[model samples]
Target: GDSVTQTEGLVTLTEGLPVMLNCTYQTIYSNPFLFWYVHYLNESPRLLLKSSTDNKRTEHQGFHATLHKSSSSFHLQKSSAQLSDSALYYCALSDRTGNTRKLIFGLGTTLQVQP
Candidate 1:
């Protein structure tokens, strides 16, 4: 079985500080698309970054995450954090091992950015 893991439960950061959210995954398939989904206060969870290319970085909304197949990691990072960056981030893995694509999501991480 495939699974995604987010070790951090809550992440707090101040404005202008860098941000990092730990993420790791395991899968039975050789290639899998890893994704970062952001969920704001009331907004629907939307895909922020996604990539299947190992060692390549994917970025969106001022955030970036690189998928490292060798280490089985895709940690999300931001150079600087903003007040608007406060939200819940979910690390997800998607692969088509059967007839449909199955997505395994990690436990959500709550990020609070203080001014």
Candidate 2:
């Protein structure tokens, strides 16, 4: 079975500060795709970053994440946290079984950026 973990349930940060959302995963498959999805208020969840290749960093929408096979981690990071960045962040894992693929999501972390 594959699983993802987001250690923090809520993270509060000041605007202009660095942001880092811890994400780690465990999967029986050798190669797993990790993703970060952001869900803003009243909006559907959207993909922020995704990576299947280990040790490669992926970035989108001012956020970035790197998939590390050795540590089984895909932490999302941003150099600066903005008010607009406040949202619910989800860490997900995708693995294939036979011809079907399944996505597993973590408990999710809420980012609250203060002005």
Which consecutive 10 residues in model 1 have the weakest lDDT in total?
94-103
C-alpha lDDT (0 to 100) for residue 8 of candidate 1: 70
Positional deviation of 91 in candidate 1, in angstroms?
0.2
Tens digits of per-residue lDDT for model 1, 6-112: 95788999999999999999998788888999999888999989975788888888999999999999999999999999999999998846667778999989999
Give the per-residue lDDT digits (tens) of candidate 2, residues 74-102: 99999999999999999998875456657
TM-score of 1: 0.93
Which ten-residue region of model 2 has the weakest summed lDDT? 94-103
Clashes of each: 0, 0
Q: Name the TM-score of candidate 2.
A: 0.93
Per-prediction TM-score to the true structure, in the order listed: 0.93, 0.93
Stretches off by above 4 angstroms in model 1 are: 96-99
